[model samples]
Target: MARGLGATVRRFPAGDLAALEAMLTEAPPGVSKMICMDGVNSMTGNTPNLVAFAALAREHGALLYVDDAHGFGVIGERSATEASPYGHRGNSIVAHAGETYDGIVLVGGFSKAYSSLLAFLAVPTWLKDHLKVAAAPYLFSGPSPIASLATVLSGFDVNAARGDAIRADLHAKTAKVLATTTALRLATPNTSGLPIIELPLANPDDIDGVGHFLFDAGIYVTLAAYPLVPRSEVGFRVQITAANGDDEIDELCTTLRALAERFELQRHAELPAQGRRIGSATPDAEVRLSA
Candidate 1:
């Protein structure tokens, strides 16, 4: 969108808050800035520290734009007596990190958690009023399908009824997969323990063979091949959800063990801790894009 608008974008390396601060400090006068980042990264399944980012945005007079596509209905506000580490209510990472929309613009969709075809933007009232006229999607896109709308409405009901239980189930299933990674001594960039887990291959050239192996094992995964990702980071991603069965998880773990045995996998101890810093930009690593 920034490219479409012909805006000059400056990207900072992921989790480099000091570098971001330097950029903000060195910006030319009269140039509007928007600090865009992810809420919960889709690849590594880690979350940025919204509190710190929000503070920086507020200080710099920039709008903090967050894409929480994978976080909505999964993680939310923390509480003393919450049901699980995922927190209470599926509001999104904005609430999960105990931040507000003061200098923040959160955009997320129902596609991941609710499996619906709707998206949303949580902006200030002034921006909301302006966007009603200036937003391209609002002015140009056709109305959403009736079926999708119905699903969203029903989803709200389901969420209100037993969302916590569903999240708990998801957490348990994800924990099982994480345990498999631990036991196999395979290194993954997943620290938040969210459903999405990426296992980088020791040999990036083996991605095709790995995909084939998983496919033949009756398992499907998102392959991050070279060009799409750097050679060193090429691998596959696994997502565990409440809908997945125990038998399926067992098969996945067994297949992962076999995969480790057949093909060399990156050991957790050998690799340094991945993305330990707060407010990292990339979902997977310290990447800088010019868009």
Candidate 2:
């Protein structure tokens, strides 16, 4: 979007608050100091501090645009401190923070947790009319199918009704995968936020090798490298869903364990105590590749 819109882009290495603050300070005068960020980072699986981001963005006279794609229906709940019990879902970013800031613009898709195809953007009522006319897709694209609309609505109902249950089950599976392999270090934030698991391999070829091996074992995982992530970071990502049961979880764990044991997977040297970045690394360690 920025490219087509002819906007100059400035990027930070990570979403650390300090990094963001520096970027904000360096932004040129008279330019809209808009900060676009993922509520739950796709690669890190860590939820950003929405309240703090909102506060800082306000200080800089900027709009904070949040992509809550991973958070929409899977995380968040009514805060115990809040008085009202009803009408607050997606407390992770939008529903809660939007109340405090008119500058917050939230956009998310139904694909991740809601299991649908379309997406939506929630902004202050004042901007809605402007965006409807300004945003090209909303103006040009054909209308969404009624069936897809119905599916998402029904899915939203279920998501709200049983989201906590689904989140609990997903976390359990993630824990199982983490515990099953001692040699493997998770690349995502160590939290119950999302069910994404990333394994950093020492060799780029090992990523392809592991992905193919998992496919052959009746399991599927994503292999990412280079542009998807830093070139130094090459590995596969696992998206755990509540749809899988004990048998499936066990099979996945067992297969991952086999890969670690059979190929002698090396734990990356630069892992933090929590294993967040697992550090950008080239998987250079030798492993068994022969069939």
Candidate 3:
């Protein structure tokens, strides 16, 4: 029988393989269950690595599980990418892997891209029989609620038809925001939609002060500091969506620049030397004697 054990691990950002290699080396022999979040869902935006990792797990005799909540309706050919214009391949890492992972398990929720309160799970045929017989939830729940099921199924159909168009619009809007920020010489990393603009500050108090200033200016952005990131890294997180227009993007950038200037955020100056007078009759020899 299989070991019937599992481990959940996060993939790296920009598809770094060093961490994943280390994880596999450290895992106990005969370990079977492995779970991962599909691209752009976590800190990592890479999806190709997930496919590669899934293949590696299979070779090591482990069952691979993926929660493609963020990828399912947002990536691939039909996603925000320039290549795929239809919604068929949007955010679907497993789908992109083709028939190689025919028996993989996938989980997705509708709360994010669809903005609905529904969840779903897809089990491959090999495990379907086992899930029907051995799965505790399936055994106890009897059947899924009719209303919720209908809503979820309906959402699937709707997304299938229009997902591509929505993703394209989102990408376009995000590009506009990036261009505007770049023109202003702001520190903005190229990302899918979650853009964290680093503020030039040396302390957490400054981050709070900046956040408050933006809020008062009628622009709301998340203030991220230590624990969420690190003490050395502080920034305002901006969530971009298709609904925001070009004008809105421009306004946000303008407001941010104005607020930064108002706070004198960039005007840091070196303090005067201790025990030194700006204008005094004391001779240079007297000042040198202190040393």
Candidate 2: worst 10 consecutive residues by lDDT?
282-291
Clashes of 2: 3
For 1-291, candidate 1 gives per-residue lDDT tens digits of: 888797878999766788999999999887888998888888878787677788998999999999999999998877777777787778998888878779789998999999999999999999999999998889999999999999999999998899988988888888888878877878887777789989999998898899999999999999999899888889999988888899999999999999999998677764333243222232223322111
Question: Which parts of model 3 have CA positions greater than 4 angstroms off?
Answer: 1-16, 42-48, 78-91, 96-103, 131-154, 188-202, 259-291
CA lDDT of each prediction against the hidden true structure: 0.83, 0.65, 0.54
Instruction: Tell me the TM-score of each prediction against the true structure.
Output: 0.91, 0.81, 0.67
Predicted model with the maximum TM-score: 1
What are the candidates' C-alpha RMSDs?
A: 4.3, 7.2, 14.5
Separately for all candidates shown, the number of backbone clashes (residues 3 or more apart, or on different chains) is 1, 3, 4
User: How many backbone collisions does model 1 have?
Assistant: 1
lDDT for position 227 in model 1 = 96
Total backbone clashes of candidate 3, pairs 3 or more residues apart or in separate chains = 4
Best candidate per lDDT, number? 1
- Encode model 3's per-residue lDDT on 30-106: one tens digit a residue: 65545444544343222334556666666656556677676666654322344332135364656544435544677
